[model samples]
Target chain A: MTSSDLQEQLNIKALNLLQGDADKIEKLIEIQMENLDTRYCPLYEEVLDTQVYGFSKEVDFAIRAGLVSEPVGKQLISNLERNLSVLYEAMNNKTQAAE
Target chain B: MTSSDLQEQLNIKALNLLQGDADKIEKLIEIQMENLDTRYCPLYEEVLDTQVYGFSKEVDFAIRAGLVSEPVGKQLISNLERNLSVLYEAMNNKTQAAE
Candidate 1:
């Protein structure tokens, strides 16, 4: 296959990997929040925040480069934002509970 | 700082990390090539190829998004391409020596 075709395949593979990792991270965060251990809360928040930020940037970059379609990029960004919000709220609730 | 500034900072940071990692990976590959162990040659080539491809796409995306300047992107790409060529030559020589 041509380089462009290879890039397209890599782009799809990257998107899939990002989505799968996001799902796994969100589920892990949910479980951690339910358990609500103060010690691990910060670590969980850090992981979620870092991964969401990094992945969102990757999606944006892909869209800008025409590696992925705009609609697909938008959807990926929306999902990531949703997950981020959930993580933020969980962190906030934990903080309030601790106070 | 504005979001644009933040993105610029991230772009710089990412570029530095990529360059540093590329340097380290290249050094490792050189050492491995010197040793000429068939067992690890495949693994080293795989790492170098995958990283070069991924980082080149990232540089392209950053340029398209205006996150990095064109000259800077061009320099980065040139460096990566040079490293890749060196790796290819090393691998080819190894194959020839074995044959």
Candidate 2:
């Protein structure tokens, strides 16, 4: 394969792996969103924060390594952050209702 | 550049980036080691743990994306962990001395 082909292949693989991780975080957010009626567990917030932190590190490394472009990395992270924000908003509403 | 050349260059870049991050964490450990006389800051421990966790995620991503070999990734993590353990041991000794 040509050099470009190899580069493209690597980029695709990197994006896919990153997306998979992001999906895991998204799944976590979705679970919390669905269980909004249940009492909020503080540990869940910590776990989600840690997961997102780790994932951002991964994306940063990928971008630095030339495996993924900056824009693509930003897109992946923003997608997850948007979902996380939504989950947090729902949790907040539940807390306010309880009060 | 040839495909092989590109691959080699990417591998080196990834390794260098990972080593740079490891060095930052190592610097943190060394600082805490030198300040053993000062009261231990629990915050330092928390920061170190979070940094290591994030760094591990980066190494994992690099390995998964095929930028670095599994052995190389493992070596990077183990080196940091070993230093962290040494720092912890010294901290333990200091605490015992104070008691």
Q: Compare the candidates by lDDT and give the number of the best one.
A: 2
Q: Every model's DockQ, to 2 decimals?
A: 0.04, 0.91
lDDT of 2 by residue, A1-99 (tens): 889999999999998999999998999898888888875686888899999999999999999998889998999999898888888888888889989
Worst 10 residues of 2 chain B by lDDT: B36-45
| Candidate 2, B16-70: lDDT as tens digits | 9999999999999999998888757868888999999999999999999888999
Q: What's the interface RMS deviation of candidate 2?
A: 0.5
Instruction: State chain A's TM-score for model 2.
Output: 0.94
Residue pairs clashing in model 1 are none
lDDT of 1 by residue, B1-99 (tens): 554555555566656654664576667657766676545457767666655655665665556544467888888768767866876787787788879
Relative to the true structure, candidate 2 has a C-alpha RMSD (angstroms) of 1.3
- Candidate 2 - CAPRI tier? high
> Considering only N, C-alpha and C atoms within 3 Å, which residue pairs clash in candidate 2?
none
What's the lDDT of the predicted structure labeled candidate 2? 0.91
Score candidate 1 by TM-score against the native.
Answer: 0.43
